[model samples]
Target: MLRTAAAAILGVTVLASASMAQDYRLNPIYQTISLRGGFTPDPYVINLQSGGNNDASRTLGGSCRGWVATAPDVRLHFQAGSLPLIISANSSTDTTLVVNGPDGRWYCNDDGGNGLNPSLRWNSPMSGQYDIWIGTYGSSRNANAQLHISELYSQ
Candidate 1:
Protein backbone atom coordinates (compact mmCIF):
# COMPACT_ATOMS: atom_id res chain seq x y z
CA MET A 1 0.00 0.00 0.00
CA LEU A 2 2.87 2.36 0.91
CA ARG A 3 4.60 1.62 -2.40
CA THR A 4 1.39 2.30 -4.35
CA ALA A 5 0.92 5.61 -2.54
CA ALA A 6 4.52 6.63 -3.25
CA ALA A 7 4.12 5.73 -6.91
CA ALA A 8 1.00 7.83 -7.16
CA ILE A 9 2.78 10.81 -5.60
CA LEU A 10 5.69 10.43 -7.98
CA GLY A 11 3.32 10.22 -10.94
CA VAL A 12 1.54 13.40 -9.88
CA THR A 13 4.81 15.24 -9.44
CA VAL A 14 6.02 14.26 -12.86
CA LEU A 15 2.69 15.27 -14.41
CA ALA A 16 2.79 18.69 -12.75
CA SER A 17 6.34 19.32 -13.94
CA ALA A 18 5.51 18.22 -17.46
CA SER A 19 2.46 20.49 -17.55
CA MET A 20 4.56 23.50 -16.47
CA ALA A 21 7.07 23.06 -19.29
CA GLN A 22 6.41 25.83 -21.81
CA ASP A 23 2.69 25.78 -21.14
CA TYR A 24 0.83 28.82 -22.50
CA ARG A 25 -2.13 27.95 -20.24
CA LEU A 26 -0.17 29.44 -17.35
CA ASN A 27 -0.47 33.11 -16.34
CA PRO A 28 1.94 35.69 -17.79
CA ILE A 29 5.01 36.81 -15.85
CA TYR A 30 4.38 40.51 -16.43
CA GLN A 31 0.79 41.76 -16.68
CA THR A 32 -2.31 41.60 -18.80
CA ILE A 33 -3.41 44.58 -20.89
CA SER A 34 -6.65 45.16 -22.74
CA LEU A 35 -6.58 47.13 -25.98
CA ARG A 36 -8.71 47.76 -29.01
CA GLY A 37 -7.61 48.54 -32.51
CA GLY A 38 -6.91 52.30 -32.95
CA PHE A 39 -7.03 52.74 -29.16
CA THR A 40 -3.30 52.69 -28.48
CA PRO A 41 -0.93 55.64 -28.29
CA ASP A 42 0.57 54.16 -31.51
CA PRO A 43 2.75 51.76 -29.55
CA TYR A 44 2.22 50.21 -26.12
CA VAL A 45 5.68 49.54 -24.77
CA ILE A 46 6.61 47.07 -22.00
CA ASN A 47 10.02 46.63 -20.42
CA LEU A 48 10.99 43.00 -19.79
CA GLN A 49 13.77 40.43 -19.99
CA SER A 50 13.95 37.81 -22.70
CA GLY A 51 14.81 34.10 -22.69
CA GLY A 52 14.11 31.03 -20.53
CA ASN A 53 14.87 27.34 -20.04
CA ASN A 54 12.22 26.00 -22.42
CA ASP A 55 13.21 25.52 -26.05
CA ALA A 56 10.81 27.50 -28.24
CA SER A 57 11.34 25.50 -31.40
CA ARG A 58 10.58 22.19 -29.68
CA THR A 59 7.79 23.44 -27.41
CA LEU A 60 5.98 25.74 -29.82
CA GLY A 61 6.68 23.67 -32.97
CA GLY A 62 6.43 25.24 -36.45
CA SER A 63 9.17 27.72 -37.28
CA CYS A 64 9.47 28.82 -33.63
CA ARG A 65 13.00 29.47 -32.34
CA GLY A 66 14.90 30.67 -29.26
CA TRP A 67 14.49 29.78 -25.59
CA VAL A 68 11.35 30.89 -23.70
CA ALA A 69 9.75 30.52 -20.32
CA THR A 70 6.80 28.34 -19.47
CA ALA A 71 4.51 31.29 -18.80
CA PRO A 72 4.15 34.15 -21.24
CA ASP A 73 5.93 37.45 -20.64
CA VAL A 74 2.74 39.37 -21.38
CA ARG A 75 -0.86 38.74 -22.34
CA LEU A 76 -2.77 41.10 -24.57
CA HIS A 77 -6.55 40.96 -24.58
CA PHE A 78 -7.03 42.61 -27.92
CA GLN A 79 -10.23 43.74 -29.58
CA ALA A 80 -9.50 43.87 -33.26
CA GLY A 81 -10.87 46.12 -35.96
CA SER A 82 -9.69 47.48 -39.29
CA LEU A 83 -6.15 48.02 -38.05
CA PRO A 84 -3.43 45.40 -37.82
CA LEU A 85 -1.80 44.16 -34.61
CA ILE A 86 1.98 44.33 -34.46
CA ILE A 87 4.11 42.67 -31.76
CA SER A 88 7.83 43.29 -31.65
CA ALA A 89 10.87 42.99 -29.42
CA ASN A 90 13.82 45.35 -29.13
CA SER A 91 16.96 44.27 -27.30
CA SER A 92 20.70 44.71 -27.49
CA THR A 93 21.03 40.94 -27.50
CA ASP A 94 19.47 39.04 -30.40
CA THR A 95 15.91 38.22 -29.38
CA THR A 96 12.95 36.21 -30.68
CA LEU A 97 9.18 36.61 -30.51
CA VAL A 98 6.56 33.93 -29.98
CA VAL A 99 2.84 34.62 -29.80
CA ASN A 100 -0.11 32.34 -29.18
CA GLY A 101 -2.88 34.14 -31.01
CA PRO A 102 -6.52 34.16 -29.98
CA ASP A 103 -7.32 31.79 -32.81
CA GLY A 104 -5.21 29.13 -31.06
CA ARG A 105 -2.43 29.50 -33.58
CA TRP A 106 1.25 29.98 -32.78
CA TYR A 107 3.25 32.78 -34.43
CA CYS A 108 7.02 33.11 -34.27
CA ASN A 109 9.58 35.53 -35.66
CA ASP A 110 13.29 36.17 -35.72
CA ASP A 111 14.97 39.37 -36.92
CA GLY A 112 11.75 40.79 -38.35
CA GLY A 113 12.18 43.97 -36.33
CA ASN A 114 14.91 46.61 -36.39
CA GLY A 115 18.43 45.19 -36.08
CA LEU A 116 18.51 41.79 -34.36
CA ASN A 117 15.07 42.06 -32.75
CA PRO A 118 11.99 40.04 -33.67
CA SER A 119 8.48 41.09 -34.75
CA LEU A 120 5.19 39.58 -35.89
CA ARG A 121 2.11 41.21 -37.40
CA TRP A 122 -1.48 40.07 -37.70
CA ASN A 123 -3.42 41.99 -40.25
CA SER A 124 -7.11 41.71 -39.35
CA PRO A 125 -6.20 40.12 -36.04
CA MET A 126 -8.61 38.13 -33.94
CA SER A 127 -10.24 39.52 -30.78
CA GLY A 128 -9.01 37.64 -27.72
CA GLN A 129 -5.99 36.86 -25.59
CA TYR A 130 -2.55 36.99 -27.23
CA ASP A 131 0.11 35.29 -25.12
CA ILE A 132 3.44 36.92 -25.93
CA TRP A 133 6.81 35.37 -25.22
CA ILE A 134 10.10 37.17 -25.77
CA GLY A 135 13.23 35.06 -25.91
CA THR A 136 16.93 35.28 -26.61
CA TYR A 137 18.13 33.83 -29.86
CA GLY A 138 21.39 32.09 -28.96
CA SER A 139 20.72 30.45 -25.59
CA SER A 140 18.71 30.33 -22.36
CA ARG A 141 19.68 33.62 -20.81
CA ASN A 142 17.52 36.59 -19.84
CA ALA A 143 18.37 39.89 -21.53
CA ASN A 144 16.82 43.34 -21.27
CA ALA A 145 14.20 44.04 -23.91
CA GLN A 146 11.24 46.24 -24.71
CA LEU A 147 8.10 44.66 -26.10
CA HIS A 148 6.23 46.94 -28.45
CA ILE A 149 2.60 46.29 -29.22
CA SER A 150 1.12 48.55 -31.84
CA GLU A 151 -1.43 49.00 -34.56
CA LEU A 152 0.68 51.39 -36.61
CA TYR A 153 4.39 50.42 -36.62
CA SER A 154 7.04 48.14 -35.13
CA GLN A 155 10.49 48.61 -33.60
Candidate 2:
Protein backbone atom coordinates (compact mmCIF):
# COMPACT_ATOMS: atom_id res chain seq x y z
CA MET A 1 0.00 0.00 0.00
CA LEU A 2 2.80 2.43 0.83
CA ARG A 3 4.57 1.72 -2.44
CA THR A 4 1.37 2.18 -4.40
CA ALA A 5 0.68 5.56 -2.73
CA ALA A 6 4.25 6.77 -3.38
CA ALA A 7 4.01 5.79 -7.06
CA ALA A 8 0.73 7.65 -7.46
CA ILE A 9 2.19 10.78 -5.85
CA LEU A 10 5.26 10.67 -8.06
CA GLY A 11 3.09 10.26 -11.15
CA VAL A 12 1.01 13.30 -10.27
CA THR A 13 4.11 15.43 -9.66
CA VAL A 14 5.60 14.48 -13.00
CA LEU A 15 2.40 15.27 -14.85
CA ALA A 16 2.13 18.69 -13.21
CA SER A 17 5.71 19.64 -14.03
CA ALA A 18 5.27 18.54 -17.64
CA SER A 19 2.17 20.69 -18.02
CA MET A 20 3.96 23.79 -16.65
CA ALA A 21 7.00 23.38 -18.83
CA GLN A 22 7.36 25.97 -21.61
CA ASP A 23 8.26 24.51 -24.98
CA TYR A 24 9.71 27.00 -27.47
CA ARG A 25 9.83 24.25 -30.11
CA LEU A 26 6.05 24.10 -30.21
CA ASN A 27 4.09 26.43 -32.52
CA PRO A 28 3.54 29.83 -30.89
CA ILE A 29 0.12 30.98 -29.78
CA TYR A 30 0.26 34.00 -32.11
CA GLN A 31 2.34 33.76 -35.31
CA THR A 32 5.88 33.17 -36.50
CA ILE A 33 7.70 35.94 -38.37
CA SER A 34 10.88 35.83 -40.40
CA LEU A 35 12.69 39.16 -40.56
CA ARG A 36 16.07 40.21 -41.80
CA GLY A 37 18.09 43.23 -40.78
CA GLY A 38 16.70 46.42 -42.33
CA PHE A 39 13.41 44.78 -43.27
CA THR A 40 11.02 47.13 -45.10
CA PRO A 41 8.62 47.52 -42.22
CA ASP A 42 10.54 49.27 -39.47
CA PRO A 43 8.30 48.12 -36.68
CA TYR A 44 6.40 44.89 -37.14
CA VAL A 45 3.34 44.84 -34.95
CA ILE A 46 1.19 41.99 -33.66
CA ASN A 47 -1.93 42.39 -31.57
CA LEU A 48 -2.20 39.87 -28.74
CA GLN A 49 -3.60 39.25 -25.32
CA SER A 50 -1.11 39.15 -22.45
CA GLY A 51 -0.87 37.15 -19.19
CA GLY A 52 -1.39 33.44 -18.47
CA ASN A 53 -1.77 30.80 -15.79
CA ASN A 54 1.95 30.00 -15.39
CA ASP A 55 4.07 31.94 -12.91
CA ALA A 56 7.05 33.48 -14.69
CA SER A 57 9.30 33.70 -11.60
CA ARG A 58 8.68 30.04 -10.81
CA THR A 59 8.97 28.71 -14.35
CA LEU A 60 11.71 30.94 -15.82
CA GLY A 61 13.41 32.20 -12.59
CA GLY A 62 16.08 34.95 -12.56
CA SER A 63 14.01 38.08 -12.09
CA CYS A 64 11.39 36.88 -14.59
CA ARG A 65 8.36 38.79 -13.39
CA GLY A 66 4.65 38.43 -14.26
CA TRP A 67 2.56 35.53 -15.54
CA VAL A 68 2.85 33.96 -18.99
CA ALA A 69 1.40 31.07 -20.92
CA THR A 70 3.07 27.69 -21.33
CA ALA A 71 3.74 28.29 -25.03
CA PRO A 72 5.41 31.33 -26.53
CA ASP A 73 3.37 34.29 -27.69
CA VAL A 74 5.40 34.77 -30.87
CA ARG A 75 8.41 33.32 -32.62
CA LEU A 76 10.85 35.54 -34.52
CA HIS A 77 13.43 34.25 -36.93
CA PHE A 78 15.87 37.10 -37.35
CA GLN A 79 18.83 37.53 -39.63
CA ALA A 80 21.18 39.89 -37.92
CA GLY A 81 23.44 42.51 -39.42
CA SER A 82 24.84 45.88 -38.31
CA LEU A 83 21.57 47.15 -36.92
CA PRO A 84 20.10 46.52 -33.49
CA LEU A 85 16.94 44.61 -32.52
CA ILE A 86 14.20 45.92 -30.25
CA ILE A 87 11.16 44.11 -28.88
CA SER A 88 8.52 46.05 -26.99
CA ALA A 89 4.97 45.73 -25.76
CA ASN A 90 2.30 48.44 -25.35
CA SER A 91 -0.84 48.14 -23.27
CA SER A 92 -3.09 50.01 -20.90
CA THR A 93 -2.32 47.56 -18.14
CA ASP A 94 1.18 46.84 -16.93
CA THR A 95 2.87 44.22 -19.09
CA THR A 96 6.12 42.26 -19.13
CA LEU A 97 8.34 40.64 -21.75
CA VAL A 98 10.24 37.36 -21.66
CA VAL A 99 12.38 36.14 -24.53
CA ASN A 100 14.41 33.02 -25.20
CA GLY A 101 17.14 34.29 -27.46
CA PRO A 102 18.79 32.27 -30.17
CA ASP A 103 21.90 32.03 -28.01
CA GLY A 104 19.86 29.93 -25.57
CA ARG A 105 19.63 32.72 -22.98
CA TRP A 106 16.60 34.01 -21.17
CA TYR A 107 15.97 37.79 -21.20
CA CYS A 108 13.16 39.51 -19.39
CA ASN A 109 12.01 43.11 -18.81
CA ASP A 110 9.22 45.05 -17.21
CA ASP A 111 8.22 48.74 -17.68
CA GLY A 112 11.20 49.48 -19.86
CA GLY A 113 9.17 51.03 -22.66
CA ASN A 114 6.68 53.84 -23.06
CA GLY A 115 4.40 54.21 -20.04
CA LEU A 116 3.68 50.87 -18.34
CA ASN A 117 4.90 48.69 -21.21
CA PRO A 118 7.91 46.39 -21.42
CA SER A 119 10.81 46.53 -23.87
CA LEU A 120 14.11 44.81 -24.63
CA ARG A 121 16.87 45.98 -26.93
CA TRP A 122 19.78 43.99 -28.30
CA ASN A 123 22.62 45.82 -29.91
CA SER A 124 24.17 43.61 -32.56
CA PRO A 125 21.81 40.74 -31.92
CA MET A 126 22.66 37.24 -33.08
CA SER A 127 21.00 35.68 -36.11
CA GLY A 128 18.57 32.94 -35.10
CA GLN A 129 15.24 32.12 -33.54
CA TYR A 130 13.72 34.23 -30.73
CA ASP A 131 10.78 32.90 -28.76
CA ILE A 132 8.76 35.68 -27.10
CA TRP A 133 6.23 35.80 -24.31
CA ILE A 134 4.16 38.77 -23.13
CA GLY A 135 2.97 38.73 -19.55
CA THR A 136 0.91 40.84 -17.15
CA TYR A 137 2.26 42.24 -13.89
CA GLY A 138 0.80 41.56 -10.44
CA SER A 139 -1.86 39.05 -11.53
CA SER A 140 -2.80 36.39 -14.07
CA ARG A 141 -5.59 38.41 -15.67
CA ASN A 142 -5.21 38.87 -19.42
CA ALA A 143 -4.93 42.29 -21.01
CA ASN A 144 -5.07 43.62 -24.57
CA ALA A 145 -1.57 44.40 -25.84
CA GLN A 146 0.36 45.17 -28.98
CA LEU A 147 3.79 43.65 -29.49
CA HIS A 148 6.26 45.73 -31.49
CA ILE A 149 9.34 44.36 -33.18
CA SER A 150 11.67 46.99 -34.54
CA GLU A 151 15.26 47.71 -35.39
CA LEU A 152 14.81 51.44 -34.96
CA TYR A 153 13.21 52.50 -31.67
CA SER A 154 10.71 51.11 -29.22
CA GLN A 155 7.02 52.07 -29.11
Candidate 3:
Protein backbone atom coordinates (compact mmCIF):
# COMPACT_ATOMS: atom_id res chain seq x y z
CA MET A 1 0.00 0.00 0.00
CA LEU A 2 2.76 2.44 0.83
CA ARG A 3 4.55 1.60 -2.43
CA THR A 4 1.45 2.35 -4.43
CA ALA A 5 1.07 5.76 -2.84
CA ALA A 6 4.69 6.59 -3.57
CA ALA A 7 4.25 5.58 -7.22
CA ALA A 8 1.20 7.78 -7.56
CA ILE A 9 3.06 10.76 -6.16
CA LEU A 10 5.96 10.13 -8.54
CA GLY A 11 3.62 10.01 -11.53
CA VAL A 12 2.13 13.37 -10.60
CA THR A 13 5.54 14.91 -10.27
CA VAL A 14 6.64 13.60 -13.69
CA LEU A 15 3.53 14.86 -15.37
CA ALA A 16 3.88 18.29 -13.82
CA SER A 17 7.50 18.56 -14.92
CA ALA A 18 6.74 17.41 -18.47
CA SER A 19 3.97 19.93 -18.84
CA MET A 20 6.23 22.70 -17.61
CA ALA A 21 8.74 21.99 -20.38
CA GLN A 22 6.54 23.08 -23.24
CA ASP A 23 7.84 26.09 -25.19
CA TYR A 24 4.32 27.26 -26.07
CA ARG A 25 1.49 27.34 -23.61
CA LEU A 26 -1.51 25.65 -25.23
CA ASN A 27 -4.34 27.17 -23.27
CA PRO A 28 -7.06 24.94 -21.92
CA ILE A 29 -9.88 24.46 -24.37
CA TYR A 30 -13.00 24.61 -22.25
CA GLN A 31 -15.16 24.79 -25.35
CA THR A 32 -14.53 22.73 -28.47
CA ILE A 33 -15.91 19.93 -30.58
CA SER A 34 -13.70 17.70 -32.75
CA LEU A 35 -15.06 16.29 -35.98
CA ARG A 36 -13.99 15.04 -39.39
CA GLY A 37 -13.49 17.47 -42.28
CA GLY A 38 -15.34 14.89 -44.38
CA PHE A 39 -13.65 12.28 -46.59
CA THR A 40 -13.00 14.47 -49.59
CA PRO A 41 -11.13 17.54 -50.74
CA ASP A 42 -14.07 19.76 -50.02
CA PRO A 43 -13.88 22.54 -47.50
CA TYR A 44 -16.02 22.08 -44.41
CA VAL A 45 -17.07 25.32 -42.81
CA ILE A 46 -17.57 25.65 -39.07
CA ASN A 47 -19.10 28.60 -37.30
CA LEU A 48 -16.69 30.39 -35.02
CA GLN A 49 -18.68 33.56 -34.71
CA SER A 50 -19.13 32.85 -31.01
CA GLY A 51 -15.47 32.11 -30.35
CA GLY A 52 -13.14 33.87 -27.96
CA ASN A 53 -11.17 36.66 -29.66
CA ASN A 54 -8.42 37.12 -27.12
CA ASP A 55 -5.08 35.40 -26.72
CA ALA A 56 -2.21 36.24 -24.40
CA SER A 57 0.03 36.75 -27.40
CA ARG A 58 -0.20 37.04 -31.20
CA THR A 59 3.19 35.53 -31.93
CA LEU A 60 2.94 31.75 -32.12
CA GLY A 61 5.99 29.74 -33.08
CA GLY A 62 7.77 33.01 -33.72
CA SER A 63 5.26 34.36 -36.26
CA CYS A 64 2.99 37.34 -35.58
CA ARG A 65 -0.56 37.74 -36.77
CA GLY A 66 -3.76 39.63 -35.96
CA TRP A 67 -6.17 38.97 -33.10
CA VAL A 68 -5.06 35.54 -31.95
CA ALA A 69 -7.44 33.04 -30.41
CA THR A 70 -6.81 29.56 -29.12
CA ALA A 71 -8.82 26.34 -29.08
CA PRO A 72 -12.57 26.62 -28.64
CA ASP A 73 -12.08 29.46 -31.06
CA VAL A 74 -10.99 26.64 -33.40
CA ARG A 75 -10.03 23.01 -32.95
CA LEU A 76 -10.03 20.31 -35.65
CA HIS A 77 -8.89 16.83 -36.54
CA PHE A 78 -6.94 16.17 -39.78
CA GLN A 79 -7.97 12.57 -40.37
CA ALA A 80 -7.72 12.57 -44.16
CA GLY A 81 -3.97 12.57 -44.77
CA SER A 82 -3.29 13.63 -48.32
CA LEU A 83 -1.66 16.54 -50.11
CA PRO A 84 -1.67 19.50 -47.75
CA LEU A 85 -3.80 20.41 -44.74
CA ILE A 86 -5.67 23.59 -45.63
CA ILE A 87 -7.14 25.97 -43.01
CA SER A 88 -9.08 29.05 -44.01
CA ALA A 89 -11.41 31.62 -42.51
CA ASN A 90 -14.07 33.90 -43.93
CA SER A 91 -12.38 36.56 -46.07
CA SER A 92 -14.85 39.35 -45.54
CA THR A 93 -13.94 39.90 -41.89
CA ASP A 94 -10.16 39.90 -42.04
CA THR A 95 -10.00 36.81 -39.86
CA THR A 96 -6.60 35.22 -39.57
CA LEU A 97 -5.99 31.70 -38.31
CA VAL A 98 -3.21 29.32 -37.43
CA VAL A 99 -2.54 25.65 -36.90
CA ASN A 100 -0.47 24.24 -34.11
CA GLY A 101 0.34 20.93 -35.74
CA PRO A 102 0.94 17.70 -33.84
CA ASP A 103 4.61 17.86 -34.79
CA GLY A 104 5.31 20.91 -32.65
CA ARG A 105 5.27 23.36 -35.52
CA TRP A 106 3.26 26.58 -35.91
CA TYR A 107 1.50 27.38 -39.20
CA CYS A 108 -0.29 30.70 -39.80
CA ASN A 109 -1.71 32.55 -42.78
CA ASP A 110 -2.86 36.11 -43.21
CA ASP A 111 -4.36 35.78 -46.68
CA GLY A 112 -4.59 33.08 -49.31
CA GLY A 113 -6.47 34.62 -52.22
CA ASN A 114 -9.85 36.31 -52.61
CA GLY A 115 -9.78 38.81 -49.78
CA LEU A 116 -8.41 39.42 -46.29
CA ASN A 117 -9.17 35.99 -44.84
CA PRO A 118 -6.18 33.96 -43.68
CA SER A 119 -5.33 30.45 -44.84
CA LEU A 120 -2.56 27.97 -44.00
CA ARG A 121 -1.48 24.57 -45.27
CA TRP A 122 0.78 21.89 -43.83
CA ASN A 123 2.52 19.70 -46.37
CA SER A 124 2.07 15.98 -45.65
CA PRO A 125 1.85 16.25 -41.91
CA MET A 126 1.68 13.26 -39.64
CA SER A 127 -1.91 12.20 -39.03
CA GLY A 128 -3.04 13.33 -35.59
CA GLN A 129 -4.92 15.97 -33.62
CA TYR A 130 -4.26 19.67 -34.17
CA ASP A 131 -5.10 22.82 -32.24
CA ILE A 132 -6.67 25.39 -34.57
CA TRP A 133 -7.19 29.07 -33.86
CA ILE A 134 -8.85 32.20 -35.33
CA GLY A 135 -7.38 35.66 -35.13
CA THR A 136 -7.44 39.03 -36.86
CA TYR A 137 -5.10 40.64 -39.43
CA GLY A 138 -3.92 43.15 -36.87
CA SER A 139 -5.46 43.45 -33.39
CA SER A 140 -9.16 43.63 -32.89
CA ARG A 141 -11.85 41.99 -30.78
CA ASN A 142 -13.89 40.96 -33.76
CA ALA A 143 -14.96 37.38 -33.24
CA ASN A 144 -17.27 37.37 -36.20
CA ALA A 145 -15.50 34.99 -38.57
CA GLN A 146 -16.28 31.62 -40.06
CA LEU A 147 -13.64 28.88 -40.26
CA HIS A 148 -13.06 26.13 -42.83
CA ILE A 149 -10.75 23.16 -43.29
CA SER A 150 -10.11 21.39 -46.59
CA GLU A 151 -7.91 18.96 -48.51
CA LEU A 152 -8.55 16.21 -45.97
CA TYR A 153 -8.73 12.50 -46.74
CA SER A 154 -10.36 9.93 -44.52
CA GLN A 155 -10.38 6.15 -44.68
Number of the top candidate by TM-score?
2
**Candidate 3 on 17-135: residue-level lDDT in tens?**
11111223565343344544344436667665522455323334334356554443555655644455566677456665555566655655555523566655545545766666676
Rank order (by TM-score, best first): 2, 1, 3
What are the per-residue Cα lDDT tens digits for candidate 2 across 2-89? 1222321221111112224567778999999999999877789999999988887788665677889889999999999797788889
Write candidate 1's Cα lDDT for 6-39 as tens digits: 3212211011122245667888999899998788
Backbone N/Cα/C clashes per model:
0, 0, 3
- Model 2, CA-based lDDT: 0.79
lDDT computed for candidate 3? 0.50
Error of 3 at 92 (Å): 1.8
lDDT of 1: 0.77
TM-score of each: 0.84, 0.85, 0.63
Candidate 3's error at 145, in angstroms? Answer: 1.2
Candidate 3 Cα RMSD (Å)? 14.0
Q: What ranges in model 1 sit over 4 Å off?
A: 1-20
Error of 1 at 124 (Å): 0.9
Q: Report every candidate's CA lDDT.
A: 0.77, 0.79, 0.50
Candidate 2, pairs of clashing residues: none
